[model samples]
Each structure stands twice: as C-alpha cells, then as structure tokens.
Target: MNNQFKDWKSNLDRFFGHDFWGDFEGMMKPSIPYINMYQYDNEVLCYVSIPGMNHPKDIEVFVDHATLTLKGKIEINHRGGHQIKAEIADGTFERTIDLPFPVRSDKIDATYKNGLLIVQLHRYISDHTRQNPVQIRHLEDE
Candidate 1:
C-alpha cells in the first residue's frame, strides 16, 4: 500500500512540478533568460526572452502537448566590437518546457518580433487527456 502511494505521489509530483508547470521555478532560478506564461480566456500565451538574436527569424518553435522546445542560433562577436562586457552564452541555444495542459496546436499561433518569441496555444477546446494522434498519409500499402 505504501509503495503504491509512493508511486502515485511521484507521478503527481512530476505532473504538477515538471509537466504541468514546466519546471519554471527550477529553470528560472539559474542565471539564464526565461520564458513566461500568460493565461487568457481562449488561449495560453508564452513569451520567450531571447535577446541579441542576430536573425530573429531563425528561431524554431516545436510543441508537443507534453513539452515545447525553442531552438535557435545566434552569432555574437565578442572581440569584433570594442568595449564589450560579457554574456552568459553564445551561439545556438535550445530551451524546453512542459505545459500545465495539453497544447492546442491546431489553433496555435506563433510570431517572432522584436527580440522575443511569442507563442499562443488555444485552450478553448484543448483536451489534456488527448495525446498527439498519428494519422497515416496514405491509406493503403503502396
């Protein structure tokens, strides 16, 4: 009985602390730029803080109901310009997160402007119980 309870508790912890909240607290506690979440009536929005991206359009956004990944490459010339300070990281970066609820990718929208990336996952009809389903392209063996 105790082992069963432990198993359930562990699962609950992961779902809430990691899966549901996307490990926000753990990731944000470090010396790194972070992503923020916003709640709306119809959607859940995410704001990724990515400063100094030479080509903002190069960013890639991937969303699985279980997680979201943002991948991009930035080239920063440390010595190319004079009188510079320091940066946490340079070159490519990848950030991932697990959302509180399953993302509604069908109704999702994403845009990158300024130095930040914004993603909107429609929540009006999102069903957390549903996993991403597989649909075959061709119906027959060819």
Candidate 2:
C-alpha cells in the first residue's frame, strides 16, 4: 500500500507541477503583446509591437536565462479636442515569456525602432547560471 501511494503521488506531481498551466495561460492571454521569437546560431531575437511609445524611458527589460520580462507604461497626451475615437492601449502593462534556452544575462541588447521593440539575447555557452539579476535596462541604456 505504501509503494502504491508513493507512485500515485509521484504521478500526480508529474502531471501538475511547475508552470505548465501558467505557460498555457501566458500564450492564450490577449492582454500581453504578441512576441515573435527566433533562435539563431548564437543569439535569440524577440520582437514586440508597441506603437505610440516614443521614448525609451517608459520601458524596462529583464531576463533570467530561462525567462524574460517586459514592463512599461504608455502615456498618450490628448489635446482639448473632444469627441474622437481612441483605440490604442495606454497605462502600465507587463508581460513574461519563457525563453527556449539559457541566455547570457551579461550580453543582452534592446533597441526601439519605428513602433517595434527588438531584443537580442546571446546564448550562454557554459552551464553556469548567472549569479546576479538581469538588469532592467531601457533603450537608452545601450
């Protein structure tokens, strides 16, 4: 009986552990910006569409080898003109993504062009995980 109970517990843990549901939710949620991620020979590139954000000071990027986080706020200045349609999203938003592979936290770059934010992360060559936290860097930090 003891062995059978242990086996059942292990099976349950295997089926419902870690972040399986959270990962599914992240992919299904529409509130987060859609990301296009691709892996290259030595780096990974992620692109996100964020229109109307004209300044670098409003964005923050962080990576922890296996995960990437983006948080920022979009502020739109509206003139006194009344009676207009507004469809753009404003206010603070955050999105977390699970990276496909371990990335070197020390060698991450981000750039904003037109209405897209491009992030490049170099693949970690060694098995060592970074001891420090990934810095939250804005576009101007480069």
Candidate 3:
C-alpha cells in the first residue's frame, strides 16, 4: 500500500509540476511592445506601446513596401534594490507589422509621446496594368 501511494504522489507531481507549467506559461505569453494599427483609404497609422524608454531616438523604425519594423530597448532603473516582482518587460525587442497595402517609403512619419509611438504612412499606388515584356528563348539557342 505504501508503494502504491508513493507511485500516485509521483504521478501527480509529474502532471502538475513547476517545470511543465513554467514552459507552458512562457509559450503562452506574447512578445513585448504590443501594437495597434488602423487603416485608412490612403494612409496607415500605428500606435505602439513602449514605456520606460530614456529617449525617443533609442527606437528604430524601418518601412518597406508593405511591412513596418520597430526595434528598441526598454530599461528599468532598479535603484540598487533586489527585484521582487518584474511585470514590465526590458531588453531589446523588434516587431514587424504587415500593412494592408504597400506604403510610400519616402512619406512615412513617426512620433513618440507619453509612452506611445505613433507612425503614419501613406499608401503607395502602383500601376498594375503596366507589365514588363519577358523575352523567350528557344532551347536550341543555348
């Protein structure tokens, strides 16, 4: 009976252990600096939440045809005391967002105020009907 009880306790520990839950918790959480985006007829706007940053210039913003990337670091001043609880995220982070349409790279603007980064982008209009003619070659010409 003692051996059976020990086996049951071990099985319970294996099922509800700290190691298993720790990994699961890490996997469930998303990355830091959560962002919200809005789309307009000719523009796209994004609002990014990143607090505790020293300066606005610390963040880097990159814009491609249809993607926007943000890179930055968040640092917390501990004041030389041992940390008891840490809910705010620190360290370097990069997040890429997909835009609804291709944006004009030269017409992008960004501003940081009150722990929020606002980005404004203009949509790029391309001529879809314009096509480049491809030259076809015969196999014997190789």
Candidate 2 local lDDT, 1-142, one digit each (tens)? 9999677766666798865555665786566455799989778999987776878767889899789899987667776888478566566789899888888889988999887899999878774654667878798867
Ranking by TM-score: 3, 2, 1
User: Per-prediction TM-score, please?
Assistant: 0.55, 0.60, 0.70
For all candidates, the clash counts are 0, 0, 0
| lDDT for each candidate structure | 0.70, 0.80, 0.86
Q: What is the C-alpha RMSD of each candidate to the true structure, in Å?
A: 16.8, 17.4, 10.6
Could you tell me the lDDT of residue 53 within candidate 3?
A: 80
Residue runs of model 3 more than 4 Å from their true location after superposition:
1-26, 129-142
Weakest lDDT window of 10 consecutive positions for candidate 2:
25-34
For lDDT, the strongest prediction is 3
Q: Which regions of candidate 2 are displaced past 4 Å?
A: 1-29, 80-87, 127-142
> Ranking by lDDT, best first?
3, 2, 1
Q: At residue 54, give the lDDT of candidate 2.
A: 74
lDDT of 1 by residue, 78-99 (tens): 5565756654445577878877
TM-score head-to-head 1 vs 3, winner: 3
